[model samples]
Target chain A: MSVSAASSRLPGTVAIGRRRVSVELKQFFRDRNSAVFNFAFPMVLLVIFGSVFGGQEVAPGISFAQYFVAGMIASGVLYTSFQNLAIAIPLEREDGTLKRLQGTPMPKASYFIGKAATVFVTYGAQVVILVAVGVAFYDIRLPSTALQWFTFLWASVLGLIACTLCGLAFSVVPKTGRGASAVVTPIVLVLQFTSGVFFVFTQLPQWMQVFSSLFPLKWLAQAMRSVFLPDSAAAGEVSGSWELGLCAGMLALWCVIGLVLALVFFRWTKQGTT
Target chain B: MSVRDVRKSYGDLHALDGATFSIEMGECFALLGPNGAGKTTITEILEGYRRRDSGEAQVLGIDPARGDRVWRSQLGIVLQTDRDLGDLTVAEAVRHFAGYYPDPRDPDDVIDSVGLTSKRRSRNEKLSGGQRRRLDVALGLIGRPRVLFLDEPTTGFDPEARREFWTLIDGLKAEGTTILLTTHYLEEAQHLADRVAVISRGRVLACDTPDRLGGRERSSARVSWIEDGVRVETQTMSPTTVVLELAQRLGGDVPGLEVHRETLEDIYLSMLDDDRDEEAGESA
Candidate 1:
């Protein structure tokens, strides 16, 4: 088995990829700044929003805190996948990490896989923490049925994939590590406010609703609402009913777009130096 | 490994213009050059990190442009200056790199070879500049590569540390690991290289053993003597003839007779100066 595997053209690809993921995760969590920003910031946002508007009802028999939990979870996935990656990737390129890895025998695809895995692990942890806080502090409701829980899992997976790919693609927008946050933060903040994460979709202006529909975050928010909110609450959506199928389709389309963009934009090193 | 007629350019500035050289297996070859002499450009092209606009480069019978991961596995490259792996401890970083190779040396042994065993548990960010460079060497060596490329490997090392590094490299050479080194330090080349190549303005000015580079062994020697309470110096292709004549003329012992052949540093500087003058004349 060892001889045959060694003779193959791409030997030990999976084993090396696993090693890369472990190394990437070790580096990511060891950095205090990344730990605080990617893991804790979203929880803080959820709490402040819950405290300010926890009691009011966005729909009949549904409290604002319940509705906001679904939105917060969706945006939290975006923060872990998109915002974190956009900053980390450029920083790696600037600091010679990518260049160092490029010289080694590790396969090129393994590097991106390592980064995606880090994002997934961090996103999973963030979700658990946010849900625990919502249930304990604000009495937020979870999916009540097996099918509802299945929707939550699938929606989270798709949303995370789309957001992660978008983050990798946007990594090239910043020329240096110092410019990464300045370039990526405003785009994420604007999307969150427009995509019904901070406010109800129908409550926003008509132009904002149309604009948010073009992106994945709006669909992610709607999918989370379908899981947590009662069926009657769907009447308050722009279409007056839950649109789970459309949400899945839109998120999947963004996944394709994001993958293409990432392939096109990703570079292993800074422009001039080898 | 060999490079022939390799040329690369950025707009109007030619980074490498038809630079050519070759290294024999198990031979320690040092590339000596002033800054911006295309040494880095050529080295990067050979390492498969940069593409040449036009040239042919072969390492271990494989074209670097077409080198795959398997091909890369056979070579080790130490970059000039890198701040990577700063978050990981020295041992962790070395062990992590060791995983990338098919057959790797023991990470702990490699770390000890680079003299970082005491700092094994310390984060790379806390290492001094010289220590960080040693870690880079440890990572490069962990793969037990057949050919090693070291780019200014001892830039930040003090004199004692540099001597230690030389001993380590000498051991690798004895083990038949081919080394292609680029450095600005002439004494380093004289000590480590079996043959040295001097590059200037993207072209090789001279290439030979340390004793014979720029025809140092055959060049004119400066012969000086004290006569009539005055020092007199003359350049002679044969210092022995001059010394014998001076002794005979002075009757007994010739006062303060000195014969000086050019040092490696002297020849290297003059070669660069001559290349600059030639380029200046052409442009003018």
Candidate 2:
């Protein structure tokens, strides 16, 4: 057969993207380790922390468990969307799977869209599960009003996009599949610890607080807090404010910056000399 | 596919130093060489996976350096290393990759063609080396590619599996798929390729049909026989003339008469040795 005859029959981008999503989702579900880590791990952490410090008040009237719920949700988004993608991309490249994909007719955008869809679905499920656990087990309140739900929706969307893009960008850091976890795990751990995922943002040291505020994780957590916590709980945050606009602005900025970084750094194959 | 004056350099090392070759449609051409002989460099260039520093390369009438998804869709590539899709079954992986192409073969048929029907449901990670190699071929063929690139496709296959793979490739060739293969296995080149290009040190020493490669057919043949209970052998350009003279002297069938031409491996080894000698002289 001639190349033109074959090329003329190439599948469209959308069809390929949809198939890629289904394939990626199937692969994700089959891997029990990743499924549990991305979905159950956040809820497990929420349970562990919520049980230990559920009674204490972090803010004037809000209990520690209620305050921590927002941060945990934020952490789940970052871990499932950003951290997972960052680690998976380099590992795939190292293992020649990315090269195989590159050899196909699928466009690069379709691959990323498929990956983004997988992250969004996984993180959406994580949020639902974590919120259910918080409301049932920790007596944490859900987003009550239309405005609160609206804030939650945009915050989750923006956070997921920023994190996933950052993850794609960071894929350049790991040279091999074996080194991906080593490179990505510590960064995730440090981000979680310092970005108020585990502790109150106001309580951390000034320098740590300032440093953490610069990252998307901190802004995401603060945004989530504004949606879930009562206005009175704002006193516990830095600047004694919810800073919803600032939160949205920072995430938007990160989205733009992360996209640019991913485009510049993301490679389908490992660096070859020739 | 056509490549002319292709050159790729990594730092001070020239991976491909002006190597050139071409393959006609429906032809199975093999780039035969040893490890580090730039067989992969040439294949990757044609596969559109890597860019050459300086070269002219056109695969399927398109410059591989600028090959897009549509161009890529027409090509099937099986890399030397295995591409395991984590926990996906062989069938699942094949089916998934099939969706990437416009016109893909039936996944089951492709799996069966590679003789992986029994292990279709088995996770790719669970497959043995040879089985995994078969899965690679299945993935490569699922797209119904016009041009296929097999890079050391049988590297990990057992002898039986290797022979099975040869038969599978024979089927592909019979269907008129344009195939460009690279291998260190001379026998594989001899068995599969319509033409074999002997590459060494990033250069094509010779490119011709397997029987004619390195002038193997015209090169001196070794004539051997038993004479008065003692073995005798002579290298002669005309084995027929030598045998005729031997028969005339013996006045009957020459005892244990045997005339042997060099195998493809012998010619290939000599080409590599000649490369080494030239390198040694250059260094001196």
Candidate 3:
């Protein structure tokens, strides 16, 4: 037999992908900055916001702190899953890490799946911590029924997937690792404010409300509100209803579009000519 | 592996005009060139990292441009720049890369072979530049590749580190690994490569064994000696005849006699100079 034929067979794609996820998670934990930003920063935001606005009432019965908890959770999902990936992917591409992995036998799909898996794990843990903080210190209530819990589960899963996919799609915007923060930070800030993460949605101007609705952040915030807030608290929302169906549909649409864009534009190297 | 009439261009710049070469299995072939000579363009095309505009590149009996994961698994690559998996220890990094291969060498053994056994527990970020390079080699070798592509592998290495790297490469050659190396270091080419291809401006100027490159073996030799306390030097097509004549004239051994031939560096530089002059003439 020829030398090539004599060599061992290539491993399965899923097996290598699992290894890539393990390796990526190991590296993620080692980066203390990312650890704090993805896992701890959201809980800190929850405490700060809950303390300042916990007394004010958003509706007849629900307090502003209770309403803000759902928004904060939505912002946490976007920050950990989307904003983090937007910056990290570009940085990795600039530093030649993506190129190195491309040269390996591991499939490109596996590389992306590994990154998505890391986001899910880290962001999932952050969600758990935020829920604990909301319940323990802030008098925030959990979903009382199995049906509400199911709604919460699907919203969280779909929201995470949508934001993470958008992050991957935006990875090509930054020219270098140093520029990633400059490109992503302003967008995240604008999204948080316009989506009513801090202010009441009904208080924002109609134009700003329409503008925010163009992106996924507002819908994600609405989705979380549907799960966490009592049904009467919907009066404070832009439409006086949760619009849970619309929220899920928008998130799923963004997921499809983002997945397609990422697959098309994702780069292994910083420059096209090289 | 063979590359024939390969052509690649970036806008108006021809990164690879037309490069052609081949490597026999188990032979160490060096692509010797200066910076921006298209050595990287050729190497990347063969590695399947980049595509060629027009050419035939067959690596391990398969076209690299269309090669699959199975084809990729058979080749090892040590890039010019460092690949950062800096958070992991040396052993962890090596073992992680090992998982990508079908049948990989033991990670511990690979690390030891690269002389990084002592640094196995150290994080990649903490290792020095030379040590990082050794780790790169270890990662490349763990795949147990039949062919290895090393692009300027010792560019930033210290003299001691360079020599040590040469020893490690020698061991790989002895184990029958086909190595395709590119470097501007002529001495490295002379020491390690069984055959050398001199490239300049996206073109192959000449390809031959290091000793016979540019017809150096048949070229004139420089004979230097001391006569009447004065040093004299002359170039001769036959150094033996010159030496005999000098011995007869001196009636004994010539004082401070030395015979010098064209070194690999001398021939390589002159070849590049000649190519540049020819291009200048053509453009004029």
Predicted structure with the largest DockQ when compared to the true one? 2
Superposition error at B217 for model 2 (Å)? 1.0
TM-score of every candidate = 0.93, 0.94, 0.94
Provide per-model DockQ scores: 0.48, 0.63, 0.55
The 10-residue segment of model 1 chain A with minimum total lDDT is: A1-10
Instruction: For residues A1-274, write the lDDT of model 1, one tens digit per residue.
Output: 1333533633377777888899889998999988888778888988999999988899889988888889988987888899999998888888778888888888887887888898889988888998899999999988898877888898999999999999988988898898999999998889889999889888999999999899998999999999889878989999998799999999999999999998887777776332
| Model 2, span A170-241: residue lDDT tens | 988887777887888889889889998788888899999889888999999998898889977877777889
Residue A73 shift from truth in candidate 1, angstroms: 1.1
Clashing pairs in 3: none
| lDDT for position A228 in model 2 | 85
Q: Candidate 3: misplaced stretches above 4 Å?
A: A1-8, A271-274, B225-234, B240-257
lDDT of 3 by residue, B1-284 (tens): 99999999989999898899999999999998888999998999999888899989999899988877887787898888875888889999999889889889999889988889999999998999889888888878888898999988887789988998999999999999999999989999999999999998899999999999999999999999999899999999999999999999999999999999999999999999999999899889
Cα RMSDs, all models: 3.0, 2.4, 2.4
